[model samples]
Target: MRAGWTWLAAPELWPGRRTAGEVVLALVLGIMAAGSEELLGGEGPRLAVVGIAAVVLSLLRRRMPGTVLAVTAALTPLLSGFAPLLMLVGWSAGRRIVGAGRALAMFSVAFVLFAGVTLQDSWSQQAPMTRLLLTTLYFLATTVVPGLASRYWTQRRTLLHALQERNAQLLWERELVAGQARLRERQRIAQDMHDSLGHQLALISVHTGALEVDPELTPRQREAVGVLRGASVTAMHELREVVGILRDGVEAPAPVDDSGLVGRGTAGIVGLVESARTAGNTVELRSAGEERPLAAAADHAAYRIVQEALTNAYKHAPGASISVELRYEPDSFVVEIVSAAAPAPAPGEVVSGGQGLTGLRERARLVGGMVHAGPADGGGFRVAGVLPYGVVEAAPFVAAEDDFRQQSPKAATVNGLPPMDWTVSARELAGGKERSRAGGIAMGCGIGVALVLVLVVAGGFALAFLVGSMSQGMIDPGEYESVKIGSGEDVVRDRLPNGDTITLMGLDGKGPKEPEGSECLVLMSSDVGDSFETEPVFRFCFKGGKLIEKKSYEVSR
Candidate 1:
């Protein structure tokens, strides 16, 4: 019941649904039609019936556009006020009508009705030719032009709706794909941590176990060895638990809560280099500037950088010499690992899958850092990264918010996603220059359109003025009145300076000029004519440059 009520209340959901405004418009159209008929001395039963029918049918235009349009067009000749109702019906048909053939047929019917009614009403007052021309022009302007404009508007609305729907679908699909990719990436990270760090812990346990059983060591040293082995085993167990949670897509507890993992932060950074040296590799480790503790994320990123670099070296370079350099600046930590190219593996060397560097890059980005890993200039490979002390998590999709901001018009003047200050900072840091160029291009296009419109309007006004001047040229009635059969043609030419001559055809058609090949001129009043009655026009004929004849006759309008 509530759903039905909601559906009825929302007129926007259905195009044909009548709202309060539509009802008001129908009533107003009916009243205006009736009032216009009364004002035009057409107050009678027929007038009242036509007015009522027009109002009632207009209200149903959305549901029956063609029928309403035909009825309105039929009544337009009787009630000039019905023209508005007819135009409204035409607009509705253009917007709501489906097939082009049907729309054309309906428009044809309306055109015929309008032309017939208009011709019948104007036939008595206007000549048949005039009535026909006027009827055709009126039908084109009132019916064809408005229909075409409304059709174009409807097409644009449909296109906009389609684009919006496609955009929404694409956004939904993108979000789903991103979620899946994020899950897979998190799982991969968990597995990489287990494989790399777990191996280190296992080695520690094995070496400590071997030392614990030695007889040469004192009781204190043996006890310390046992404690170290026990700690390594315990760490391995905790690592497994964390990896399990990651694989299940659950949020792992905070690093500290999960046995102080982040607190141990960059402790593994130096061990990574030492471990490589212990494993029969010629590796040199150097540090410049004072070493200071970093933020949790930055410290973790630093440890991962060294770990992945060494892992890559051990797999690809094998016995090649490697150099690891760490530079601690005032506000950042930089790590670089450079290794010489390696020879072909003798046998049983681990093959590289290129996953270590991928993980390293991900880690660096998460900690507001950048990583570069590629072949170096001197026939070696370099893996370098820079980690800032105060790290911020890089947003996964920073540009997407800009699109949302543009499409959404809700509370647009106020910042919705973030305050203007933050938005400005983000845009500047994330290619604001490119967006500025786009905005400049858009603004330029708008200015060009405005300039073109102004030019077109000015040109139209100038053309109208030129035509008016050419149409009403200078005419001399006194000189024409004095001209007789004995006058010279030169005197007549001097009287009328401005060139104003037209073919003296019958009522704007060809009639006759006295004597074949003789020069003839027609002179008439310059004042604008108001009545339809024919006016007298003076005709002059000149033979051998001498005015020979003059006559006057009425020219039919």
Candidate 2:
């Protein structure tokens, strides 16, 4: 009723089903667009328009998807980014506006447009396969296909549920008709038995009463007839009630428990193990690694794995010892259940299969994990599943946000401590420090260029001042000549504990004023070992408290 019925005013229907994919596309576009612009040196009005538009488009994507896509596409040729995104959006819109079948035709045109833009960035179509593959994926996988596939699955599930309900109704009707026929037959039998048997019994009763009154009637005969009459009356009443129930012909459904169903967890698994042991079967449960609050999918998988294994053991092995291990790790948790093979399984002994393993696999996979089941190497059959410990770190929390945050920390460390210098620790770094680490060599290069620029600008100004002063005759011939224009060098040197020379230099236009002198220095962190460098060095004449020398740097490791 929720979906089958029409809804003009419902809020959920309009934005309805954004799909993880659309959001991902928007993110990719934003990040790639931002990165490429920064790579080419983000500046100028054109870059600003495109950058702002791409950001806006990413956030409000679903509302005006085509327009957003078009904006990004138009900006691609003017800016520097993959233009295929525009086509992806165009395809998605065409699928919605016209039809999904038309999506390919529109998307092909979009791909060609992207290829044309790509040509401007690189001359050779040498990486044609790469571009084509990426383009094709963007067109098909990221947009049109996802929307179409989603629709198909949703519709398929709805149709299946409808068919189930209809089948239930049809089955109920057929059973109702069959019961009506049985009830009619029972009614007729009841009538015949009541009419014929009751009349004869009544006549016999009268005769018995006469006999009892007569002195010739024996006590034994009187007692026997009295018992027969009583038994017949009781049978008549019981038959009538049975006839009424058959006549009603409705299923007396077992009561529905509004208390809802109990969910299985660690405790639930323990109880089930205990119950099995009580039935004279041996069962053991073991857990390893740091405990975590599992995601619903993982928890469900764990519960079902043990439940199915135990059920199978009960049906086949009966009294075999079983071991269940729930090993939690940094990245995942493993659920292993082993049960001894049945000594003599009955002919109709049911293997615990059908949907159990399938459901468990699906559950595990849903959380970016997997399941395994096989005969154990030593003896019994084993079912083992690995559930991703930090599934949400790779995805947004769709169902339980609070629970996910609480579990993510310990879960991310399951497999091992992250690679060196990489961690999920909550420690915060200063902005300057973060920039230094992330920016690295490139930042060093930038600082070098900035230093060159600053020196060039300052030298020009210093030269101009000299020129103007000379024009005003403020300097004598010797004064200008004596201030010899020579190559400048500012050296930073230090004596190491091991007695090695550490030299840092600022090289610029050759001038007499540089090198082998008291060079201006800023920060001196000697602990960094041997050397360090910074550029676009600030001087007192060009600095203040509200100042930032915004110079870039290069560091050698």
Task: For candidate 1, write residues 128-228 as lDDT tens digits.
Answer: 45345546656665666667667766686566556545544554565567768888987999999999999999999999999999999998888778767
Clashes of each: 3, 18
Could you tell me which 10 consecutive residues in candidate 1 have the lowest summed lDDT? 409-418
Using all chains and alpha carbons, the TM-scores for the candidates as numbered come to 0.49, 0.33
Could you say which candidate leads in TM-score?
1
Summing lDDT over every window of 10 consecutive residues in candidate 2, give the lowest-scoring window. 491-500
Q: Quick one: best lDDT, which candidate?
A: 1
lDDT of 2 at 1: 52
Candidate 1: where is the Cα deviation over 4 Å?
A: 1-18, 44-51, 121-126, 174-200, 213-216, 223-227, 234-242, 254-557
